[model samples]
Target: MTSLLAILIGCLYAAAIYMMLRRSVVKLVIGLILLSNAANLLIFTAAGLERGVPPLIEEGQQVIAGTAADPLAQALILTAIVIGFGVLAFAVVLIHRACEVVQTDDMNEMKGTD
Candidate 1:
């Protein structure tokens, strides 16, 4: 499962980079979303997958007991999800306003941009 997740992360990175290089506003937004997800998955991969055990210590136990999950990874992913959503929302709103002004989704239409 870890290997599969690693492969999926690679694919996500590829797709995200590909979309990010396109010349469309919508593609850029999609790429950003993909990139954020990839990063979150990367964190998960780095944290190691420990199943069937909780990430807590019982009474009188001085350590993490068993194959407990890393709570830090979960917290990081949650924070990343919220931040990514906010950023994507802002990007979408900006894109919508730009489309209204420029009348197109092409990246080459805005003034003073090369």
Candidate 2:
């Protein structure tokens, strides 16, 4: 399962990168979303899959010795998701304003004007 997840994450990352290189603004946004999801999945996979005793420290509570899920990775992924959403939102607004002002989605045309 880990290997399969790794492969899937790799494919997602590749597709995200390919889309990011395209000239379309919408494709870039989609690429950013895909890249963020791929990164989250990679982190999740690295944190181990088998569930064991919870990390909580309390009376009669014991931590597992083997492949336990890491909470830190999960936290990191959550943070990344929030940040990605914020960035994507900003990008969308920026793209919308650019389209309104410049009247074109072609980045090359925008660059030529400068």
Candidate 3:
């Protein structure tokens, strides 16, 4: 499972980089979304895949017993997801406004705004 995830993450990163290099604003936004997802997946991969019980402490235990999920990784991923959504929303609005003023989505054409 980890190996599969590693491969998928690699492909996502590659595709994100490729899309980001394109000349279209839409493609750039898509690339940014993909890049953020890839980063989240990378974090998950680094955190180790364990399907154990949730990270909870019993009434008399000082620390979590046996194998347990990593709360820190889950928190990080959740934060990343919220940030990614905000960035995506901002990008969409920016693209819409830029298209309205520039009348084109091509980065090359948007270079002469002055």
List RMSD in Å for every model shown.
Answer: 1.9, 2.0, 0.9
Q: What TM-score should be assigned to candidate 2?
A: 0.88
Residue 42 in candidate 3, Cα distance off native in Å: 0.8
Candidate 2 on 7-111: residue-level lDDT in tens?
999999999999999888878889999999999999889888877665666667575455555789979999999998999899999998987887888777766
Tell me the spans in candidate 3 whose CA falls farther than 4 Å from its real position: none
Superposed Cα deviation of residue 67, candidate 2 (Å): 6.1
Model 1 score (lDDT):
0.91
TM-score of each: 0.90, 0.88, 0.95
Q: Write the per-residue lDDT of candidate 3 for residues 1-114, one digit (tens) a residue.
A: 999999999999999999999999999999999999999999998999989898889998898879998889989999999999998999999999999999999999999776
Which structure among the candidates has the greatest lDDT? 3
lDDT per residue (tens digit) for residues 1-114 in model 1: 999999999999999999999989999999999999999999988998767476768899898765777788999999999999999999999999998888889887665443
TM-score-best of 2 and 3: 3
Sorted by lDDT (best first), the order is 3, 1, 2
